[model samples]
Target: MQRYFIDSNVPESQKISIGIPHYHHIINVMRHVSGDQLIFVFNAGETYIVTIEEVEKETISCHLTERLEKTVELPIDVTLACGLPKGDKLDLIVQKTTELGIFSIQPFEAERSIVKWDEKKETKKRQRLQKIAQEAAEQSHRVHVPEILPLLTSKKLLLELAQYTHVFIADEEEAKINEQKVFKKLLNTMKINDKLLIITGPEGGLSRNEVTSYIEKGAISGSLGPRILRTETAPLYAMAAISYEFEL
Candidate 1:
């Protein structure tokens, strides 16, 4: 069944109108007809079954039929911060990480980050990442769409570390990789609404000063494993591992 993300304000027994783009897919591309059943999520853990009523030029209206089981969502909030990698790597990271159940993603400009996104480029970059995340959420059957935060500099991001309950910075030089030990600490220490921010650097990784600044901000340094992972891969790895540990 086709799944969609809708605003929570849409009430039961009322008309469910979808946007033109999705309407086109349902009407023209997928060739769905009246009375076709669909699944919708207002947010995480909220699902509803609806049947198509009318398909028009700009909108598709459906009748809310029944309430489905709440979609499975991650238990903990995990935000993966990547040190903006070069080329299309960031797209893959955002799409896959979203499917794996990350709460959100933030791309930061690290010391080794090569690509620069000024005001003009930042807008376009954000749109592209957001599109990728949305499509991924749909493909993975996620109930809620994860947010892709605006790009930030490492220093600027570090300044806000206090907001998160626990901040884990992925550094290869950190002590041995013990997913259990790190997660155990998180289990023993973390509570609901506690944001877990995981930072991963670019190809060349972060500079010593950058890591030091993160440390000063109280972000604990953690190692993923013995082998080094790419900048784009590291964040996904950290997010998936954390979701497995904390959510499952």
Candidate 2:
């Protein structure tokens, strides 16, 4: 069944109305008709099996058939704070990481970052990335879509580190040191419901001073194994490792 995220309230009568893009997707794109079943994820993060009862010119009416109890979210909330990379690397990172169970994404300006997003560009890019996250979440059958946070500078990101239960930074320098398993060790210390922030630098990677500043703010610097990963690849690796550790 096709899945969609809905923002409106699901009334006690169990009857729901959908409009615009979703209506178009159901009627034109997917060619769904009355009696076809689809999954609806509500704002409260509840998933319901809904049956289309009426297909109008602009609206699709659906009735809740069953509420699903299944959850695919990571036990721990993992937020990715990535330094703005060049090109569309952030798009790839958001889509893949959402599938791999990332909770939220934060794009920051790093000391070595080459790409710059002005105010107007930042708003447009955030809107685009948010749509990507929603689509990815639906495709992955996720009950909750990952949030695309506003852009922040490295200094601003440091100030917000206190909100998370734990913070980890992917440092290339750590990869060169043999027998460093800080990532694994940190994972071992994690528990259910913990909120973790994983930070990765852009193409040029984070500077030494930036890493030191992060460490000062209580973030543990770790390597994503011995190999140096690209800006986009690092977060995916971390998400996969987290899924393996906590889900598998």
Candidate 3:
């Protein structure tokens, strides 16, 4: 069955109406009819099996058939903060990480980052990334879509670090040191419901001073392994490791 994320509350009468994009997707794209069944995820993270009852001019009416009880979210919330990379690398990161169970994404401006997003570009880019996240979430059967945060400067990102229970920065220098397993060690320490922020640098990677500043604020610098990962690859590696540790 096709899945959709809905922003409205479940009706008391168990009747639901879907409009616009979803309606178009059901009617034109998916070619769904009145009797077809679909999955609808509501704002509260509740998943329901709904059956289409009536196809209207601009909307499709669905009747709630069953409320699903399965949980598809990561036990602990894992947010990825990436130093903005050039081209469509960020797009790839958003789509893949959402499939691997990222709770949210934050793109920040790093000292070595070459790409810059002005105010206009930031808004447009965020919208596009958010759509990628949503589509990926639905495809992966995730209960909630990962949020795409507005671009932040390195300094602003530092201040936001306090909100998370744990923070880790992916450092290339750490990869060079033999027997460095700080990332795995940190993963072992994670408990259910904790909030973890994983930071990955861009093409040129984070400067030593930037890593030091984050370390001083209590973020642990860790290697994803012995290999140096590209700007886009590091976060996916981190998220996959997280899923292996907690979900698998």
Candidate 4:
């Protein structure tokens, strides 16, 4: 069954009114008609099996058939703070990490970032990334959609680090020094529901000054493994490691 996230008060009425993109996907792409079955998730993050009852010219009406009882979210909240990379690398990071169960993704200006985000393009870029996250969440059966925040500056990111319970930065220098246990040790120390922020640099990696600044702000600089990973690869590796430790 096709699934869609709908913003509606489902408790008051079982009938759901869907229009535009969803209607187009259902009627045009999926060719769904009255009596066809599909799934819809409401604002409360509850999934429901619904049967198409009416298909009009502009809207599609669906009636709730059953409410699903399932939870596919991670035990702890994870926020991935990535240094803006060249090209569309951030797009891949958001999609894959969302599948791996990230709570949110924050892209920031790094000391070594080669590409810069023009202020005029920020809205379009953010919307595109958000759509990617949404689609990935649906395909991965995630109940909560990962939020894609606007790009932040280094100082702003450092200021926000105080809000998280734990913070780690994937530093190549740390890997070079064979600093292997900090990430795993911190994961072990974290309790359920703790919010973790994992920061990684762009292509050339974060500068010594940037790493030192984040460390001073209470961020633990750690190695993903013995070998250094690419800018886009490190964040995914961190998220997968987190899932391995907490979920499976």
Q: Ten consecutive residues with minimal summed lDDT in candidate 3?
A: 172-181
Across residues 44-148, which tens digit of lDDT does each residue of candidate 2 receive?
Answer: 878777889999889998999987765597767999999999999999999999999999999999998899999999999999999999999999999889999
Error of 2 at 56 (Å): 62
Clashing pairs in 3: none
Q: Kindly list the per-residue Cα lDDT of model 1 for residues 117-162, writing each as its tens digit.
A: 8999999989999999999999989888889998888889987788
Q: What is the C-alpha lDDT of each candidate?
A: 0.77, 0.88, 0.87, 0.86
Model 3 scores a TM of: 0.72
Candidate 3 segments exceeding 4 Å error = 1-70
Stretches of model 2 off by over 4 angstroms after superposition: 1-70
Candidate 4, poorest ten consecutive residues by summed lDDT: 67-76
Can you write out model 4's per-residue Cα lDDT over 1-248, one digit (the tens) per residue? 23588877576677887898798888998787899877677888887778889999999887898776644776679999999999999999999999999999998999888888888787888999999999999999988999988899877898999999999999878785557889988987775468999999998888898888888999998899987688889988998998888655
lDDT of 2: 0.88
Whichever of 1 and 3 has more lDDT, that candidate is: 3
What would the TM-score be for candidate 2 when compared with the true structure? 0.72
Give me the overall lDDT of model 1.
0.77
